[model samples]
Target: MAFLKTIREVGKYFHDIYSGVASLMRGMKVTGSYFTRPGSIVTQRYPENRDTLKMFDNFKGELMLIHDENNLHSCNVCNTCARKCPNGSIEIIYKKVEGADGRSKKILDKYVYHLDTCSFCGLCVPACDELALKFDQKFEHAVFDKRKLTKVLNKPGSSSKTTNE
Candidate 1:
């Protein structure tokens, strides 16, 4: 009975070794196929393919305000985007401006966007009911200084149409 138990243990050990070797060979086979099939490899050469490199439509890189040709933006300064931000990346500063009507309305003065703090969760875009916000595809946002990461999204001379107007 002891000799039979020893034989069973040896058989189990050999099976484990065989299973490991078979798994290793399977992985190596996949690697070998990739080497032979050049088209199967999707490794991109950076900088050289910059012009041809196409970003997907759904790719979320950074948030930017859409300013029209007339320098008119759709942001209503409702503070929805700032409030919806999970990381408090958006800081909006606005002052009351007299609209076409006699009453005063809040117009965007400064839209501070801290990129470093932003998690790129894409909450701010949908929070804007005006559809003024969008993700900018240009992903090269690296800067030498942390202060430089803070960006003002509202362009100069850009204003939104007042609801009362």
Candidate 2:
């Protein structure tokens, strides 16, 4: 009985040692793989690699209004994007204009996007029924003043060409 008890204790000690070595090897295996794989290296030399760096197609950086080839935007100024914005980042100001059909229509005067307070939750893009809102890939939006972050989305003097066409 003494011999059997001694053998069992020695077996448990060896088992614990094996488990510890296995855990260590498993961790080292990941490190070794990363060290061997060139593509696994994700360090980008900033400013130097900026010219060649490519952003993914689905990467959402900032909100922008989509203008057609005719320099016309499709926003009807319904204020749906502003209403859906959780943080009051979207501020739209429009004027009621009488169309040729004698119907009063809301024309977009200014579409202000406050990036300083924006959460970028991406709800405003899908909330727009006219597909007017989209995400632009340009991410360099740092500004010295918080008020400068407030941008008007539309190009000046650009009108709704499709509507008038």
Candidate 3:
């Protein structure tokens, strides 16, 4: 009776081992099929075909200040974007300037954006309220010198040129 019980236990162990092997083989077969199918490869050459590539509509790329036809950006130097930036990459300096009506308005003296430290979060854009900021989809930002990555997106005193101009 003892020997008969030992044989039953061995049979059960072998059955379990066979089931595990069968499951493993099934998984391997799926992987093997994928390897043989050249059309199933999901990798794309990024730099070689950047023009054909498309980014998400909401993809956060880089922050830019939009200049209207009047050579002026809508940013009122509210500093809301600088405060809301999680990475502290945005620095806006406000300068008091007299408008054509002789009224002093807070204008942006300097808009410094450190692209290296920027998280590319769109939080700053909406926080602007004036719609002065936007995400530009130019992602070819790689540079040999890290310092070159820090840039001022807006040109000084030339913010009013329209796209046609």
Please provide TM-scores, in order, for all candidate models, with all chains considered together. Answer: 0.74, 0.71, 0.71
Report the lDDT of model 3 for residue 95.
72
Q: In model 2, which runs have C-alpha deviations exceeding 4 angstroms? A: 1-42
- Each prediction's total of clashing residue pairs, residues at least 3 apart in sequence or on different chains, is 0, 0, 1
TM-score, structure 3 vs. true: 0.71
Q: Global CA lDDT of candidate 2, please?
A: 0.85
The lDDT values for all models are: 0.87, 0.85, 0.78
Candidate 1's residue-wise lDDT over 82-130, tens digit each? Answer: 9999999999998987767677888888999999999999999988888
Best-to-worst order by lDDT is 1, 2, 3
> Which stretches in model 1 have alpha-carbon errors above 4 Å?
1-37, 163-165
- In candidate 3, how many Å is residue 7 off? 2.9
- Give candidate 3 misplaced runs (Cα > 4 Å): 42-48, 68-72, 94-97, 103-105, 138-144, 160-165
RMSD of each: 4.1, 4.0, 4.1
* lDDT measured at residue 106 in model 1 versus the true structure, 0 to 100: 85
